[model samples]
Target: MTRKTVRIAMNGVTGRMGHRQHLVRSILALREQGGLELADGTRLWPEPVLVGRREPALRELAGRYGLERWSTDLDAVLADPATDIYFDAQVTSAREEALRKAVAAGKHVYAEKPSATSFEAALGLARLARDAGVKHGVVQDKLFLPGLRKLSRLIDSGFFGQILSVRGEFGYWVFEGDWQEAQRPSWNYRTADGGGIVVDMFPHWEYVLHELFGRVRSVQALAVTHIPQRWDERGKPYDATADDAAYGIFELDGGAVAQINSSWTVRVHRDELVEFQVDGTHGSAVAGLRTCRLQHRSGTPKPVWNPDLPVTHSFRDQWQEVPDNEEFDNGFKTQWELFLRHVYEDGPYRWDLLAGARGVQLAELGLRSSAEGRRVDVPEIAL
Candidate 1:
């Protein structure tokens, strides 16, 4: 069977995610797969035409990747008949405008998470795409993690019967810009640029929570800005306008509860950088990024709570390495492939703008809860 090559115009090609999705994922990785060839010898390759605001950066990126087609003019790129899709990894502030232009030009759209700073803007973008009759997707890379996949299998198989509750501990101490080189982008600490831990990460948690347990019914959150000011890349001090840490409690259907603690100011002293522990009436499971620990009903044991007592329970020993069955790419790269297949093959792609809007809703609710000192009910998003 003949394969169709989908041409992609990549916006923000000079940015971090743009470089990864365009040069590494779309160009190199997909090319290595013989253009998304199936086991049965079918192929679907995406030809990338890089686009960015800076001509020098775009030219440099194009030369580095040996890409013959590149441009700084978004309008011209959208008007080109050869482009079938508009890919965006632009800053959150620029997404709505860029996607509006792309949909107006009749191109399918795919973009990074937190698709918009506001829920209304995200809804508008989704409606615009739907009205234009174009496929659309938002990156949900955590769903593709191998460890999470194992947990999903366990849940499906009833390993954790009658699940009770879930706890997520995710964080690592990020250096303050004044003391050491800041690890994350400067805009991430500025409210003007839609920077905040809740806005940036809750979307991931929303999808994970919905996928694992159920939809969130309500959220009560407490958010804090630990570092009030930070230095930029140029070593100039600037006020940190976004919260660096957030503690959230989510109530799911069926009386189940989930607690999430996300911070950029805490050090990791655990087996992995991120850990999720789910407790149930039948058994309990603890999952790290690369490992899973299971304690079934039969293996349950009671131990002393004395801090001086020698630890007897083999809690850490129960964890085993998950065998790799298929070659898995990096999280971002994996989502890119799925989005590509979703656009071309009509695959099951549900990470649409509405889902992205839910993320914005959660963030907005969190902020309101913090300010008003009360819990916020998350209203359902109508697609």
Candidate 2:
């Protein structure tokens, strides 16, 4: 049986995430890794039709990838009978409208995280996709990271017996764009563009926590803008309206707690910028980018409160380095593969719009908590 080739129409193909991460890293790189073979034992390569506002940019991208189909009109691409799926990596502000259009056209949809800025908007998109009977997914890429995979294994193996809490330290110093060029997009600092760390990242935490422990019952958080101004690619300065940092505490089911500190201002002092420390009754584990350290209760040395003594026995000793099992690719690419597999082969892919909405919920609640000076209970998704 010949496998059905999935024709993908990518909206916002020239944007930062669209060009570097989603298009180049995910779609192109995944094909290089090895295209998907369906359940019927037929091979398929994602045939993409690049859609964007700029013709020259689209042409350049298309030519670079040997893509024959490219267009500037999104509606035309959506209306094309050849398009099997619509992939969106557009800005958050543009996502709901584009997704609604695609779903109305009866196309399967795959999109980047924080599907929309607000929870209600995300829920509406989810309902639209469901009503259209289209397969839908949002990127939840962190779960595929090797370090997180190892952490999940530890949790599943009962290494972290009666898990008490989890701590995450995520961020690095981002350039101000005045002296040095900003590492992220300039639009990220603008609220109207759907830019903020809480909205951008909390969904990632939601899935991670849900996967590792359980559902998050509530969240208490504070979101702040550390840098008030930033420069764009062209060196133009703009007011930074989005929060650059977020401190959040998630209350998980079964009484476990997760604390997430996400910022763009902190300096990285370890192997990777992102790290997680898990503490349980039996033992504790600290996982950095490629390495993990384990300290069992039996090995935990008791010491008096001394300010001068070297803290040697506290969680230390590097475990074996975890090598990348999949072909070298960004986290987004790995997630893209999973979504493709889910769509074509019926592989397990639970990271749907509901999951995406949960992230938005966290961000919304976090902002509310910060403004109201109180904790916010996370609301359950309607569907």
Candidate 3:
């Protein structure tokens, strides 16, 4: 098979998501597997240059991963004509300006969301990329999840006659870093650094709900900082200005409502860290990160809310497991391969920068709903 190398300038490679997901698991894994196969007996190879602020960190990462290229100066990498793509997994606050610069330099751009701190900034970037005539994309990794894929299949197969509502429970307890070390980074608790549950999880919920049901028409949210203060990575205490938990209700276009509770302070009680239960007229299904269970109308048990008597039937045991028909890859890697195909081949990619802006818009609207204690309407993004 003929092979083509697409040189990628990857920024924020020193960060957790950037280094692990984008660099190692996706791009490098593709290279090790002899590149992505195109339909026309051709392969696309990802050639990435590690770009970051710290040269030492970049050098260490490159050497550890057996990479030949590492650059601290982003401008220099952008100026290089060999760089075909500029990928960013940096913080949401830094993504907009970096994307602008990358687009101006005539490179295809892709990044993690919420793409920017605000909707205006995100839509502007989308518009700018469109004007620059570059292929732009955003990371919507959850859509490719195994469980969600199954759920989508059920939807497509008409397993549910008429979907009614969806309830999503996501999150696990994150240590305050006093006695035990925190799982997430310290910046996630700081609003000044663009960290909050509403901003982080709303984007995921928006896309998930839209993909499963329809576009979100409105959002109502309640946000709270459960732990007002927490210890940082250096063991220093700092005030947590961002919302640690967000309880939101999104109204979809088809009159379906999705209720989601996202928090860093909550304990997991489901099959996975995140789970979604969709109730419909004909049947119901619950999906986690890697597994899905379904309950048909004929198989569903009748339960009576009797406080006087002890429960006899086990509710959890009534549901049947969904069969896995195909092998599943890492969700991040799946999207990366599709993005590469969209960039090089004539692959149909709908999750563009405009789609990303919709995510940002949902987050922004969710915050507004929380602040004003009212439902906020979501407007369509033209870009």
Return the top candidate by lDDT.
Answer: 3
Q: After superposition, how far is residue 150 of candidate 2 from its true place, in Å?
A: 0.7
The numbered model that scores best in TM-score is 3
Per-prediction count of colliding residue pairs?
0, 0, 0
The alpha-carbon root-mean-square deviation between model 3 and the true structure, to one decimal in Å, is 0.9
Clashing pairs in 2: none
Alpha carbon lDDT of each predicted model: 0.83, 0.84, 0.92
Report per-prediction Cα RMSD to one decimal: 2.0, 2.3, 0.9
lDDT measured at residue 78 in model 3 versus the true structure, 0 to 100 = 96
List clashing residue pairs in candidate 3.
none
- Cα lDDT, model 2, residue 41: 75
* Candidate 1 least-lDDT 10 residues: 318-327
Off by over 4 Å in 2: 1-3, 309-315, 318-330
lDDT-better candidate, 1 vs 2: 2
Cα lDDT tens digits, model 1, 1-383, are 76878889988878876686556865578877777864455687778888888999988888997878889889999999889988888888998899999999999988887888888888888888888899998878777777787777779989888988999988898888787998888898999998989888888888898888998888989989999989999999999999999999998877789999999989998877778888998888877776667788887776568988887667666544445556656766777777777776776788887788777778888888888888888877786
